[model samples]
Target: MTTYASGKIQTRWATLDDLPALKTLINRSIDALQVGFLSPEQIIASHAVMGLDTQLVEDGSYLVAEYDGVLAGCGGWSKRATLYGGDHSRDLRDPLLLDPERDPARIRAMYTDPDFTRKGIGRLLLQQCEQAAADNGFKTAELMATLSGEPLYIASGYHPLERVEAIGNGANVPLIRMQKILQP
Candidate 1:
């Protein structure tokens, strides 16, 4: 489903057809946006820690933001047990569904194209994900945020829940676990 169109930017559910572009956008975002916020080693580790969770696309929960038809950002909410990490992450994969009343919705794989930073793409994706989760009966949402992404999630009302690290290529990557109550 398509959501709010502000100027030339639009949001919609992502599909397998968009996978190639999404992968490119995600890699570019990780490469260009993680600088300063992450040590070079951490950035390398990030590649193993973050990426496209195709299940989100299959579940039809992932949303992509486009600026004049160019993919600018992507994110999604999930009912699955996994809290974060992409399909390729070395972490355990859990496809089990979560009960809306018992588990907070998982906000997975949020990324904004570096060229599109400060353009409201991330905010737009967050709004869409939160609203969709709420509509599906989830009362709260949680995400694993990179240092660079913490500011935006904080501004959007998510609070830190914990600090965790993902290890890859012998590099330690820090991540913040954050949550927010979804407004009814």
Candidate 2:
């Protein structure tokens, strides 16, 4: 837990019980922040491809940031092959376990509430995820970042690897793939 200008920010592993609030927070954050870069349809479509991945909660890797008792942000890192997707992904694939010795830990589903933007909540959650990943023996991290989220990832030392179109709801949404070397 940390204190910021907004209030007390607390982070903890998300549980299945956190799903309802997490989903609401994520969708709200995405809709509010991505409007400038994405169309309404595109944003709605993205939900099908990008939303809460319950598996993260099951793995105890998903985290939620609360500001004075309110959901402010959420994110997590995965030790599996799935890079990005939500519960509603069309092309369902088994989450292949990754070899932490060689594979990059995946940073997944990062979202910050609009009211808490720039208040350091996202950064705090990200730091926690990175530290946890490193502690698990991962040397590097990767993620598919929304345009609105690219800045935060870059500011945190992630470098762009490629720009790709994620097919969501029959629409092509531009997303950037980024990677970062985790420091010991």
Q: What is each predicted model's overall lDDT from 0 to 1? A: 0.91, 0.88
The residue-level lDDT of candidate 1 at 86 comes to: 82
Candidate 1, superposed: residue stretches over 4 Å from native: none
lDDT of 2 by residue, 8-127 (tens): 888888989999999999888878999899998888878877888899999999988888888899999999888998888837434999998999999999999898898898888888
- lDDT for predicted candidate 2 compared with the true structure: 0.88
Tens-place lDDT per residue, model 1, 61-120, is 999999988899999999998888888974646899999997999999999999889998
Which residue pairs does candidate 2 place in steric collision?
A: none
Q: Which residue pairs in candidate 1 have backbone atoms (N, alpha carbon, C) closer than 3 angstroms, thus clashing?
A: none
Q: How does model 1 score by TM-score?
A: 0.97
Return the TM-score for each candidate structure. Answer: 0.97, 0.93
RMSD of 1: 1.0
Candidate 1: worst-modelled 10 consecutive residues by lDDT: 84-93
